[model samples]
Target: MPEAKETVLEIDLGALAHNYRYLRAKIDDGVKFLSVVKAFAYGNDSVIIARKLEELGTDYFAVAYVEEGIHLRKNGITKPILVLHPQFTHFEDIIEHCLEPNLYSEKILRSFVETAEAKNQKNYPVHIKLNTGLNRLGFDHPEIGTVKEIISSTSSLKIASVFSHLAASEDWKERDFTVGQIDLFRKMTWELIADLDYEPILHICNTSGVINYPKSAFSMVRSGIGLYGYGNDKNIDPELRPISTLKTIISQIRSLDKGDTVGYNRAFKVEKPTRIATLPLGHADGINRIYGKGKAGVFINGQYAPIAGNVCMDIIMVDVTNISCEEGDEVIVFGGPQHPVKFAEAGGTISYELITGIQRRVSRLVIPE
Candidate 1:
């Protein structure tokens, strides 16, 4: 275990396990669980996170693209990897790497079937995405006939699972919509099952869906943000522990007199003798530029050091005028005493964006459980 002396992301596998168990407890014992490790496990090292989840008995893992799954496979991940939005060009790679393709449209379905047939694959596993309401991807309920036709026409493909995404499972106001989505999913899945005479694993719930609609857990559920320790609901947030801490060491602390300007464009003007601490990271490291101009603060010496002026590509200055801090002091941009959700809210964004936006250049240290 090494201290974060520079800009680093400290990932706590202990807290990740706690979140996994916590979410798992919400569903039935027999239900399967899929942990999403896409976007580098939401910017926390995909291979490491998947390994930890695999150790905890995660039934499946999902990534947004084929390369991510291939990366996991290359790193010794043997569990089923679902490419949620795979491209037709990568169908060969998907097969060669044993990564499951999510057939969301007729074109993808037919194309993947052809690729599998060419590769001499038999009963190759594939997940079907249904467009219940999100409308982003997946085939519409009416397209089930086409979906069935495509599958029946090819012996090379097998339906591993049928799933959909909830539009707004976290908001109480959208509860009715979420329920409608769930009901539609149930109706579509059973209808498809009736025609096929065999039931593949059925799932539609995400993190919030698992919490708000446990009864609709189906055969399996997907946990994305929740596994990273965010419930996405205020009431349930207290139970989950944040797993990542973003820390950076102050490069220098400079004194500024009244009327002195700080940072680019003179965005922050000192009213009195102020101490400005410059950090070695900024928007390039995923601290969004929107967080500047006093909107977000970093934790230092048990105090808040407000951001001063505009965020730079590789630097940011924070006003630590009133705090007792020196050069090389550890600053917590997010996590530990401060949560990323707070920073997200301050920046008018979401935690998913804030966390996943973290650049790969930053070191990710896994904290022992």
Candidate 2:
């Protein structure tokens, strides 16, 4: 990999391939693999990641919204793109772009049916989302009859798949809850499937679900974070390689005397003589403000340098008094020896939030396999 001259998110396609293959090996031969590439592929480049996954034989691709799917389509993503949380307003565009929507409610289902009919679409693929335990999106158990009736009443739409989301599949203490969710999903889908003439693909496992619940794999499994090299478990994490490396360079270095404060409101007052290195990224670039004031540190010169003051919009000062580093030295914000999970933990967050929160302003450097 090239040394970072500026703040850049280095995307390792080799790691991506390894992660995909590792996850792929966990499932049965016939089970389909759906890769979730939403939130700009978890704050990495979506198009680049999706293209690589597409080449790697991903059975399907999922995104949070129709626009995300459309973006992939425009960028040569030919695999079936499932829009997980589509709005009624974009029904026309969804159909026009050959993107499928996960209809989770009566209103969305009915609206999509109407739109499909108006567009003269026949048997357009649509996925049914059920609310087993997540309580976020998806139709309830009682709504299954209504869902069936609406779909039964329409020739424009067809059930492509039936799926649900797992709320706490990663936590061992939530094992019973996750299992109950899986059981309920199976029972509900069976009830719905019995009423229909054909069986749509059944899926409920997310990345963690895939690792924890193998029997619940059903017809397919959707993985988001796992493909980005996080299994949500410490034991499994070592088996997967993180695909993104957030790196920045020291913009400037300064020596400060005792009691010398740094950043806005003097949030950091040097207790003694200190050397602070200013990095070119801060809150605006996805380094959360909560990571300021000695919470999180950057890896510099084989050592860790904690943020000395409050994170600014475009800059952050790190105490590098002990590190033998200078201006323009490459710093690992997260990745390599400093994992993103560790960085996120320092700020009381998760890797998902930290990675997905990365701003679009940062330059992306793709490291091909």
Candidate 3:
């Protein structure tokens, strides 16, 4: 990859392919793989990532909203795209873009059915989300009959898949809870599918679920962070490579004398004479303010330089006292020797939040396979 002159997010499609194959190998041959390309493909270039995944023969793609699915369709993505959280207002647009909506509620289901009927659509694909253990989205067990009644009442809509989200599949401590979720999903989906004219794909595994729960690999599986190169498990992380590298360069170097303070509110007081390097990216660029005050560091010339003080809107000062670095030296914010998980841990966050929080302003360079 080319050296970074300014802050940039380098996306490696080769690594993405590797991760896809790794996850694909974990499931059965017939099981379909749904790549979750939501949140701008988790803050990378969605169009580029989706294009590559589509080329790799991903069975389906998933996004958080209708606009994201529309963006993918506009970018020539031909595969089926699942809109996980569709709103009533965007139901028409979702159908217009050939995107499937996850009908998680009665209101959404009825609204989408009405919209599809209005459009004179027949057998429109839609996903059913069931709330097993994760209480965030999806219909509860009590609503399964109502969901079926609504589906029965509409010819404009068809259930393409019935799926649920795993809340703690990665945590072994929550094994019982995870298994219970899987069992509950299976029971609910089976009950719902018993009377249907056709079989809908049943799935409930996320990346971690794919790794830990092979038995629950129903008909299809969804992977988000794992494809971007995170398995959410230490044992599996090494087997996959992170696809995005957040890189920046040392814009300037400052020599601080004893008793000198740096950044807003004088967060960092120089106990001894030190050299600090100012980077061209900061909180606005996705390096959250919680990573400030020596909480996190960037890799400079193979050595780690801790963030000196508070993270500003467009800049950050790192203590490069011990590192032999100068202005314009490539600094790895994450996705180098240190994984994004490390940086996220420093701020009490996760790789998902850290990566997805990356702003759209950062330039992206794709490394093709």
Candidate 4:
């Protein structure tokens, strides 16, 4: 793959395949694997990532919206695509593309039934989401009865799987809470499936959940962040590999005096004479202003720079006085070694925020194995 002319996220499809194989090996061979390709595959080009995972024989693909699933289908992804959060507004389009919806709320369940009936689809796959402890999406224990009623009443709609999100899977300190969620999901499953003879596949493991909570492994596990790396569990045998590399280049360099201020409103005042290199990416490019004035910065020429001043929309200045770097050289923003800017620590945000926040304007170049 050719290097970016300016700034880009190099997506390694090989690494992606590796991560897929790694995660798949961790679970049972019969259990299905659903790779979450939502948010442009975590802001690294959904079509490309989904294509790679699909080629690897992944059981299913997931996205947050109907449009995203349609995009994957448009790009030749025939593998099952699951829409985690389907809005009622796009029900018809979702039907046209044959995308399955994870019906969480009672409103969504009733709406989907009507839409499925209108579309005249038979046995249309749909996932049942449960709100064990997260309290975000999914039906509660009391609502599962309603869900079962809806499932039985609705002819064409079929319950594909029942899933729940883990609040804190990696923190063993929160093991009790995680266990409680698993137990709750399991308890609710029997009641939820009460009259229905066939058990829809049950999946409750998130990336960290899959890694840390083995007993909770029901029928499938939704591996998102772990597949893209950044998982916290060290005990996971296959090891998670980061599949995306965010890179940018210094646009210019300027020498500064001790008393001189930098960036908007003089957010940072130079403590000493310094050589500052300004990058061609900022909040507009997913490198938010939260890194401004006090955070560590991009690594260049085997040395780390210090972020200085308020991050502008299209530019950020870093103190590179101590490093040997010049304009046009690539700057490692987040990912890779020798600096390894953990996305979570980028600005006190999580990896999901960092990856999903990358601007669409930034070019994404895929590197196939």
Those runs of model 3 whose alpha carbons end farther than 4 Å from true positions after fitting are none
lDDT of 3 at 347: 84
Candidate 1 colliding pairs? none
Q: Which regions in candidate 2 have their CA more than 4 angstroms from the true location?
A: none
lDDT of 1 by residue, 1-369 (tens): 454698999999999999999999999989999999999999999999999999999999999999999999999999999999999889999999999999998888888888899999999999999999999999898888888878888889889999999999999999899999999998988877676756799999999999999999999999999999999988888999889999999999999999999878899988999999999998999997899999998999779988999999999999998999889888999997788899889989999999999998998888978
Question: For residues 1-369, could you state the per-residue lDDT of candidate 3 as single tens digits?
Answer: 899988899999999999999999999999999999999999999999999998898999999999999998998999999999988889879978899999998888888888999999999999999999788998999999999898998889889999999999999999999999998998999889899989999999999999999878999999999999998888998999999999999999989999999999999999999999999998899998999999999999999999988999999999999999989899999988889999899988899899998999999999999
- Give the local distance difference test score of model 1: 0.92
**N/CA/C clash count, model 1:** 0
TM-score of each: 0.98, 0.98, 0.98, 0.94
Give a tens-digit lDDT track for model 4, residues 1-369. Answer: 454458898888888888888777778668888899898888888888887887798888899999999998888999888899999899999889989999989898899899889888899999999999999998999887788888898678888888889899989999899999999998998888878878898999988877677556788899888777657654552366678888888889999999999889998888899899988888999888788876757778767887888989999898899888778888888766422235447678766788888889998877788
Model 3 clashing residue pairs (backbone): none
TM-score of 1: 0.98
246 Cα displacement, candidate 2 (Å): 0.8
